[model samples]
Target: MGRAAAAEALTRVRKTLVSVPNLAKVMANSPALVKGWLALPGALSEGVIPAPVRERLAIATAQYNNCEYCLSAHTYIGAHVAEVDAEELERARDAESFDPHIAALLALSDAIARGRGRIDERQPKARRAAGVADAETAEVAGNLAPNLLADTDNEWPVVTPCTHN
Candidate 1:
């Protein structure tokens, strides 16, 4: 994509996700990565797992990996867009979700973040009992792609404090 088109794409993506999308300012430099970013959310959203579930998993993974930028971004998305509550957000930041279903997904997300996508046996069993399918679990893992990339980027360039405005 040309620079202008890429700029437009970034604007649209940021607008779709956040009003002042701070992370894109750094990430849009890589066009190839943008392509993957474009596809990931849609693919994950298409799965049977709810969008809020994906957000919870993403928040857990971000916090597990100590990515405060992702934690912040996903926290906003989770609360404003996904309608997740303050208690749930705190649970995610603490890596201790009380909701049984979310707790299971958080376990899978934690394992994936720590083990780099290699899940322990017990997590899947818990998810199974929660009626979450393997395919959905895989999608949850995939949904973390943007969070991981954003978190990595956060370590390099200084991302200033952004606002809802």
Candidate 2:
């Protein structure tokens, strides 16, 4: 993609006004990556799982990897946009959740993070028992992958503001 096209795409899909320098760096290096990153969240947003639950999964994944950028950004999104409370935020950071399904999903997130896409069979059982679907479980796993990428790419503590434009 040309620089103008990439910038336009980013401007069109952005959810906030703050610009991330590293994101621009990525766009310059890999427009396809930027395109996919922008698209995945929207696709997952259409999934059955609630946005907050998904954000929780992202939070847990970020926290587990010690990615301060992803952790802080997702925390703000969870709190202001998704209404995730303080306790839940705390739990998510630790990869624990009170909601049974969320707990199961968090466990799955941990499994994916640690195992690199493979999860133990027992984890799926708990997730299903908590009313999570096989497809949704997979979605949670998929949702976390890009977040991990963004987290790994950005600098620690993520100086970038919550930028969209």
Candidate 3:
């Protein structure tokens, strides 16, 4: 079998009785979805965007969409990749305290996930002060699109499941 098919088979076999199918299985059936997932890791690791800020953006997007799977995935990634502790992740999850820049990014991501594509003036200003440039902000906003679109209750596009998020 092909790699994708093999992965899917493995996922299915591993979760014979689980109600929520493994996200890896879901992604294996969809190339575009997998592409988007791959893009996130590469973009976040590029050093232009700080890892904490990226995780906040990701977690905020997932939260706004009410995607439990994405929330869980991003939370773990935040701790692992961003080196953010569980306490910080909890605060971010609760819309409480975090690094100022990370908080602003999360707020911006929340706005986007809620269907407001444009970032507010205050948020951009805060992000700029926090060391994020306009170009970087735009990129962060763009990165959030797939997650936002996927989580829309009204849309529900045929995306592959992402086991990691």
Candidate 4:
């Protein structure tokens, strides 16, 4: 199939999985997962990290993993929730010529996705320089674990349903 066809197929599947009825049932049974997902947006909103940067990281990671669901979801969230401008979002989607800090965060997220929590020293150091505390970094790492796994498992049929435990 062509790229467009594949993307459309994925989008249809994602929409089905994340439909309100489906997610409502999942959230009702899996409160912990819901909570963790909620915490990610809460942290970003509370300034644990700049929302734009965090969204950029998410988008880059999703793209690297070829997770169509996550890429579309993060792209939407990065623009809507994070208030990232279109130009910056496009830069992140392309993973080129972005801000140094955003680039570093994307690199770190990529490492985490591939290494499964065994990121290089430079990853944490770069996050630190970006004003992300160890605690916050750890939290983000924890949040990313399941996301990466879900993407790998092809469980994300929709925009990745959020969980709030």
Q: Is candidate 2 or candidate 3 better by TM-score?
A: 2
Clashes of each: 0, 3, 5, 8
**lDDT by residue for model 4 over 1-165, one digit each (tens)?**
355544444444355444432333333344455455455556555655566777777776666666666766677877877798888876665553357655655656667767866887777777777765665665456445434424232233244332210
- Please, what are the lDDT tens digits per residue for candidate 2 over residues 85-121? 9799778876789887788778878888888888777
Per-residue lDDT of model 1, residues 1-165, tens digit only: 578866876876776665435566556777566667767887778777787877787777666666667777777778888998888876776455778777767777677777776877787777899876778777767776777544444432222322221
- Against the correct fold, how does model 4 do in TM-score? 0.59
Candidate 3 at 156: error in angstroms? 22
Q: lDDT values of the candidates?
A: 0.69, 0.72, 0.60, 0.58
The TM-score of candidate 1 is 0.78
Q: Rank by TM-score, highest first.
A: 2, 1, 3, 4
Candidate that would win on TM-score:
2
Q: Once model 2 is optimally superposed onto the true structure by TM-score, how far is the C-alpha of residue 158 displaced, in angstroms?
A: 7.2
Off by over 4 Å in 3: 1-21, 129-131, 146-165
> Per-prediction TM-score, please?
0.78, 0.79, 0.65, 0.59
Residue 124 displacement (Å), model 1? 2.9
What would the per-residue lDDT of candidate 3 be over residues 1-165, giving only the tens digit for each residue? 377765655454355323323564455466455555556656656746677767766666666666766777677767876798878776666454557666666666666556467555676667677786776777676667545334322222222233432
Choose 2 or 3, whichever is better by lDDT. Answer: 2
How far residue 24's Cα lies from its native spot in candidate 1, in Å, is 1.1
